[model samples]
Target: MVAAADAQNYAQKLGIIHGLVVQELGWDEDTNDDLRAEIEETIGSELLDEDSDEVMDVVLLWWRDGDGDLVDALMEVTGQLSDEGFVWVLTPKTGNSGHVDPSEIAESAPPAGFTQTSAISLGEWAGSRLVQPKAPSKQR
Candidate 1:
C-alpha cells in the first residue's frame, strides 16, 4: 500500500477535492517496535488536537492495480467508523479498463447518499442528472 503522504500527493495530482491524508497504522507490517510506537504517538496527536474537528466525510479510493487485502482492511476500518460520518469507496469496475465505479458494498450499511456518476470529474458528470428526495403522496 502507498504511504499516506504519497497517496495524498497523488490525489492532489488527480485534482481530487477535500482529500485529507490518513495513515492506517494497522496496514503496516515491516515496522519495528520503535517505529510502531512513534506512529501511534503521531496518530494520537493528530486525533486529539484541539483545533481538529470530528471527521465528517471520508473517501477511500483503491486501485485494481493494488492488493485486494488492502481493500478489505479499509472496509473493516470504515465499519468501525460508520457512525461518525459518511464513507465512500471508489473501486475499479470489473472487466473495465481500470475505470473506477463508486458503489455501496454493504446494503445494510450504505453510505448516507450513494449514487452513480458518469465520470469521476465531479461537475462534468453532475449536471446530466437531477437528484432529489422523493416527495410524499397526497392522501385521499
Candidate 2:
C-alpha cells in the first residue's frame, strides 16, 4: 500500500486539483482502489463515470491488454473531455498481469487524435498521459 503523502503527490502530479470533474472508465476488480481514493480526495468529490454528461477536466482510463480496441476507447473519451483536459491511460506495469506494451499506446494515440505526453509508474500501474494536439499558432 502507498503512503498517504505519496498518494497525494501522485494525484497532484496527474494535475488533479480541488473541484475538478474527473471521469473514470474501465474500472474492474483489478483496478487500484487506493489510487482512485487519492484522486477523489484531491478533487474533493467522487470520480464520475463514463455516463456522466458533464465535461471533464481529466479522464482516467484503466485499460488492459484485452480491453477491446485502444483507439476506439480513446476516441470515445474525447467527447467528454474539456479542450485542455487530458487522459491517463493506466495499465499494469511490465511483468504484471494485463500489462500493455508502451509501443502499443504510442501506436494507438495518433489515430485517436491524441499525442503521448508522458508516462509514469503509479504503483502496480503504468500511466501514460495523452492529450489532443493543439493547433499550431500562426505568426504574421
Candidate 3:
C-alpha cells in the first residue's frame, strides 16, 4: 500500500512539473489554469515531503527565445515552494554563441543559486519556430 501511494504521489508531482513546462509554452488559458491548479494541489498535499528547514533545489533552463517572463514564472513557482521549506537552483538557458554572455542575466537580480548555462544554438532555436506543418489543401 505504501509503495502504491508513493507511486501515485510521484506521478502527480511529475504532472505538475510538466504542467509548468506546458504553461511556459503559452498553452491555452483553460489548459494553463487546469495545470496550475493541479500543480498547486500536489505541492500543497505534502508530496515533496521536505522538512521546514530543508532547502529545495530547483533548476530552470529557458530556451534561447525565452525572455524574462520565463525566469519570472520560475521565480514565482520557486517562491511558493520556498514557503514550504524548499530552495531553487534556477539555471536560465543561454545561446551557444561564443560572443553571447550569460552574466547579463545573472546580474539582473536573478533568484539565489540561479546559474546560466549554454543551451541549444540560437539558430536552432529560431529555426524551430519556422518549421511548422502545412495545412491540407482546400478542395475546389
What's the lDDT for all of these models? 0.32, 0.92, 0.32
Which pairs, if any, clash in model 2? none
Reference-based lDDT, residue 41, model 2: 92
Worst window of 10 by summed lDDT in candidate 1 = 123-132
TM-score of each predicted structure versus truth: 0.27, 0.90, 0.25
List of clashing residue pairs for candidate 3: 56-86, 56-87, 58-89
For model 3, residues 38-115, the per-residue Cα lDDT tens digits are 555544533232223334432222323233444464454443333222222222224433222345444432453233
Can you give the lDDT of residue 31 in candidate 2?
A: 94
Span of 10 residues, lowest total lDDT, candidate 3: 123-132
The residue ranges of model 2 lying beyond 4 angstroms of the native Cα positions read 1-8, 137-140
Q: What TM-score quantifies how close candidate 2 is to the native fold?
A: 0.90
Q: Give RMSD (Å) of candidate 3 vs. truth.
A: 18.6
Better of 1 and 2 by TM-score: 2
